[model samples]
Target: MTWSIVARDPETGHLGIAVASRFFAVGAIVPSMRGGIGAIATQAFISPLYGTDGLMLLADGQSPESIIATLTDRDDGCQQRQMHLIDGQGRNAAFTGQKCIDWAGHIIDDDVSVAGNMLVGPNVIAETLRVYKETEGTPLPERLLAAMDAGEAAGGDKRGRQSAALKICRDQDYPWLDIRADDHPDPLGELRRLYAVAQERFLHVVETMPTRANPHGLTDRRLIDEKIAALEAARIADGRPSPSFATPLKPA
Candidate 1:
């Protein structure tokens, strides 16, 4: 049993997904996205092809609705699956198979699509959308965490928690961030800690990594180190504690 959200940040054009489940490593198969194509979450019976093929279809100029129809039409197991997606244009669609376990359904918004099966109740999806809409000014990743937190508070997957994941993609071929708590008593909380760990230095390091537009991106190691140090200093000065999981930077 699982619940997930696939969304496009309208202002940033970033795409991502956040998911929690009783299943192990739900993130590995349920969520998928391409920088500018779109994002998808396929769950319940977990048809991974919906994620891989869905992105391919989204890249091929198919709307989210068309993609869903095509995907479910070709699969005989559609009746047991749960899926939803948002397209490059922000067009959204979802499918909760007729035979999915109880408390299964989806809710679509202007830029988001939320879906779940075997959840505690409709409140799981409802509270997720509510919190997501109310926290619009927050960054995409934080907003996603907030929404997921609300769902958990409202009673998440009826079977209980086992894993969680967060994936974010910016304007590049590679993901900007991808973190998972594959098997944990508190997967979402673990995910939040990892998010804090990423902010400590990893995220800044990502900004300096090579990209298509900047093949030799910020290669001056000393300068990059200076930037990260400066950020850490500023964060400490503001009274925010640094993530303890962050390790000392070793010299090159």
Candidate 2:
């Protein structure tokens, strides 16, 4: 019913997940992350509690395997559940329950996990990992998107696609970057397009901000001068003339 990837960019320590399913608002249920903590994706007998509870365990210094065991041990429904977890250290773990529907499986790689249940084929998870690893030199979101595209191409959810989502986070004031395309006919493709648009918007905003607020913190004095010049030009264009000074030399 769903396919997902939970991953960390080793170079940047950024955490992210990409997911799609024949389900409504997959973003709301399938992805969860906290800055400087970890990320979780729970689906197929989808246990929403795992998202919060797992993060709490991670916060308490639990390993991914230990956290997974605790959750699976407490739940009688574990056999039908699927989950993927990645810790702050980039340790990854994933599980697909025994009773899940056909073509259900998962792949755990270095700092990443890909999982799916009732998928078109077992190759979905494999292809997801392949794409994630092979698509290098790209931003975290772009790499995640590439993994999602590979899963879709390998035949995603057996039930078909309804919604898709991406979530990424870093250690910043506002670390979450989430995008979703709910109730779309081609949700994965739409998600990819939206991700590209979002990247463009982010770049545009960065380029437009005052230099004093930029990462370099070096003011662009020329830009300020250009703006002042533009304002004066606007006033001149509107036919507003400067006042002239007069002298009284004859009276003197």
Candidate 3:
């Protein structure tokens, strides 16, 4: 029903999760993260508590392995659950219940973990990890997306695709970027479009938003506006396509 990647960017210390599933609105339920803490993806039977409680454990300096054991050991539904996490220390771990559907398992690497249940086969997670490792220098968001794209190519959720999501967190309690294709014919493609659109304007605005380091953020908009203008100019100078818009369809 679902497959996901939870990773910590080695270069930036940013944490991110990319997930796709045959279930509707997978994004809202599958991913949870706190900057300077860790990330969690809870699926299969879908215990949201794994996310909330898991973060508390990570905050307490609990290892991903201990957190998973503590949560699953107490849950009656552990056999039907799948989860993975990576902590601030860059340690990672994953779990797949024995009772989960066939083709369900996980892979844990240095600072990343990939997990899934009811996927087409093992190649899905394998290729996902492979591409993620291969794309070392790329930004966290794009690297996660590229890995997911490879997983999909390898045969994603066996049932089909319905929703996908990408979340990135840097040094804030909230995400740097959180986008979803909750319900769509091509969820990942929609996510990519949204990511492109974000680069045009939304991300620049996000950069100006208040954060712990800069409580005032950028009260003046002039600088941000100039930055965006400069980027747009650079694109044009490079002969790149202009900023794009998703136009609404006219009534049939």
lDDT tens readout by residue for model 3, 1-252: 899999998778899999999999999999999998999999999999999999999999999999999999999999999999999879988989999997999999999999999999999999999999999998888999999999999999999999999999998998889999999989999899889989988888988989988999999999998999899889989999843665743878
Q: Tell me each candidate's TM-score.
A: 0.94, 0.80, 0.93
lDDT of 2 by residue, 192-241 (tens): 77765554334334344434235563256576456555755786799974
**Candidate 3 residue-wise lDDT at 178:** 96
Error of 3 at 183 (Å): 0.8
Q: How close is candidate 1 to the true structure, as a TM-score?
A: 0.94
The models' CA-based lDDT, in order, is 0.92, 0.83, 0.94
Worst 10-residue stretch by lDDT in candidate 3? 242-251
Ranking by lDDT: 3, 1, 2
Residue-by-residue lDDT tens digits, candidate 1, 155-194: 9999999999999999886899999999999999999999
Native-referenced Cα lDDT, model 3: 0.94
TM-score between model 2 and native: 0.80
Better of 1 and 3 by lDDT: 3
Best by TM-score: 1
